[model samples]
Target: MELKGIHHVSALTANAADNYSFYTEVLGMRLVKKTVNQDDTSVYHLFYADEIGNPGTDLTFFEIPRAGTTYPGVSSISATSLRVKDDNALQYWKQRFIEYKVDHDDIITVGGRKIVSFRDPEGQRLKLVSDETNNGVKGGTPWKKGPVPVENAIIGLGPSHLTVNDPDPTIKVLTEVLSFKEIDRYPSLVQGQQDVRVFSTGEGGTGAEVHLETRPDLPRERPGRGSVHHVAFRVDNEEELQYWKERLQSARLPNSGLVERYYFKSLYFREPNGILFELATDGPGFTTDEDPEHLGESLALPPYFEQDRERIEARLKPLDI
Candidate 1:
């Protein structure tokens, strides 16, 4: 059973309203789901994605109001990328970042693709990669109603970046256990470090690759606001998700088995270096409970939480999006 590409990447934010504004207004992504964290109902769990919140398009955030700043190092999902149409789209975004006064770097090539690296107000590391030369795992459609024009809008997720002290353990899990094939390598942006290795799954394109960097000199990351919580890969359905759970168990890896995310099923496990990875299903998506036209317009809770909606809503701080 081969897994699909990325399903979603969840990060942390101290302020849901500000996060909402930045992702929707500045990044031009649609706020597809405004919901509470299932584990803790007091805070917000916001999802931003391309039009209709398709699988592989989601970039989610968990609100941790008092979270501290992230001290970047090894064993972290150091950077998460969003895909754009082409090289021209990168130029459009570069200019737009200047217009918005957003923190960004000039367009640069990474692993044979053009990309513009940037950060959110909370210092969450992000990159916009051009899909001009991509041939595998097609990206999602942009939100037409968002601020940016369709041609220049952000599409879906690209290769996720992982930093580790030693790459062998992580590489072993990715290759032997997860079935990701090492496809390419590129010079590390950091001087004197080993070259970054590229790994791909499923269709093997921009959307399906993982960029692994080894940084033995750095310490473990202190996760807080702006740090990625976990990165999820796509599973086709519940059957496949169950298979993955069994596979994880058989491999003697500790995991959260068969998590009912309501919108989708999931199984979460951490690799050898402590980076959280989740295998998630593709169907029963954001549109499950809310109308596509009005997604994120109101607070959404799973069926189990419906009875407690009043109390849940009372505990949540109103997001002024």
Candidate 2:
């Protein structure tokens, strides 16, 4: 029943190429894995993160051409934060954001740590906070290439904060089934004093925060063209997956049917808060597509796409990865 922090976060983007450019060239995240959505082979499922593409470091995207508009409401989520080495790293990120011509908010203090916020090409909110100050940067991602040096690049996920209308079910799921403890709570500056509660895994050292802000004056989120698709948490293997399956059933929570995703098996569910949550197994990971040493060098696909590799490669717009 011990959950190992967030596995990865997935967002929907209008263009895979644009998302690729920003995450790689601008933000300096490594292209850890590249493949098509297994369900819809034409669409791309891209993942970007720190070195080795560790679980929490991941921020994923799905590019579907026809998916319609974005609605910002109670159900929609906001900025997902990444952890950096320290205040100096935060300054490094600020200048990088400026150099790339990406819009960013001035540095703001949250929970006694400094964080800088910015948007990806598709307007998904993201932030980089000082890792040491947050006391969550026990890990590091080595940079393969970019303006930001390895030491300054993001360490990994700080927290995937959710803005939920009802915190009870989400809290229950986190504490009861997922084995997350109520670490602490505080007032947040990002959303004007939204109650912030943090939870960390006994195993991963990565943490997730839940922010509840009463925006009675504002509208709830409508998910469409550009918004989070789902957020996944890591489970080590089939044993862990089954543990969660029984746990969810016991709690009377609904689950998306289990799916074999090549690299991992996954279970999906929506929290009462309306955010899509997934539990994905840890491995037969990127190596499934290419050897570990040569991963992300070309258009990699799951075994199912191996037969169409030639056509799939021709269809995707060429990039200088």
Candidate 3:
């Protein structure tokens, strides 16, 4: 499998407008698409990415007001990490966060790298790491119209850190099933034999890592607001996608058969630790429906939900930002 990196990371949001404001104004990301949740047409499914909505640059959200508080424990995507150009860009964001009065932690060094931990308005955990080691952009674009200048802008999604109950089976999924290379391992945060293992694909840059931080003592996490819904990895095209589906089938791990999300083709499956993983195709991108310059300006619906547009438009509130 030619896994490029993170295709996108989708999490839940209680308020749509606040989510939009935080990602667009505070984080300075582009709202590439404003579409409804295909499974349920009433709620809005928003996408925030770099300039042209590149594959690895996407961080999306599902506005679900009725969802309860997020469960902070094992079997969850505990944090979504992003990478910037260099330390100067990292410092620029640190100062920018302070100026905007955003909630964030003091800088911390982990594994000889600087990272700034923060949370969105909805309490979703996020981290920004300097891309000093990895020179590649991982396929991204700078949003000139966004709040931050191009240099200081977030390059793309770095990694989706998975908090698993047991690391062994999850490791098997990555190393055996997904063909991820076990690059390194480190001591665990908790005082025990448990530890964090880093795996990667496609040359293993910043965004390409899949960190399995085993915290066996914690309780199992349930789906709700502020929790990651799913983490998607990118594949080149249809053939690679089919190969992965066959791998999953041969492994006897259950999967969602070829789902069309309008912008991309997706396959959903849960690993041994119960974290949902998606294999998404890279082609037939966001430009299929709307023009590049005018994405996310108005509502866009899939063909099946076109007739329900009137009702869908009525239920979802307009984004103030």
Would you estimate the TM-scores of all the predictions?
0.99, 0.90, 0.96
Which residue runs of candidate 3 sit more than 4 Å off their true CA positions?
135-139, 189-193
lDDT of 2: 0.73
Model 1: lowest-lDDT 10 consecutive positions: 312-321
As for candidate 2, its clashing pairs are: 71-222, 72-220, 72-221, 73-220, 73-221, 74-220, 74-221
- Per-residue C-alpha lDDT of model 3 across residues 1-321, encoded as one tens digit per residue: 468778899999998998899899889999989999898888989999988788898999999988898879988999998878777887888898899887898777665567888888778999998787784336478888888999888879987789977788998998889988988777765677565788889867787888889776789987788889989999988788889999999999999988888788899999988889999998788888889998888888877788888889999988754
Which of the numbered candidates is closest to the native, going by highest lDDT? 1
Q: Candidate 1 on 61-82: residue-level lDDT in tens?
A: 9999999989999999999999
Lowest-lDDT window of 10 residues in candidate 2?
204-213
CA deviation > 4 Å runs, candidate 1: none
- The C-alpha local distance difference test score for the whole of candidate 3 amounts to 0.85
Judging by lDDT, tell me the better candidate of 1 and 2: 1
Best by TM-score, which number? 1
Q: How high is the lDDT of residue 71 in model 3?
A: 72
Q: What lDDT, from 0 to 1, does candidate 1 have?
A: 0.94
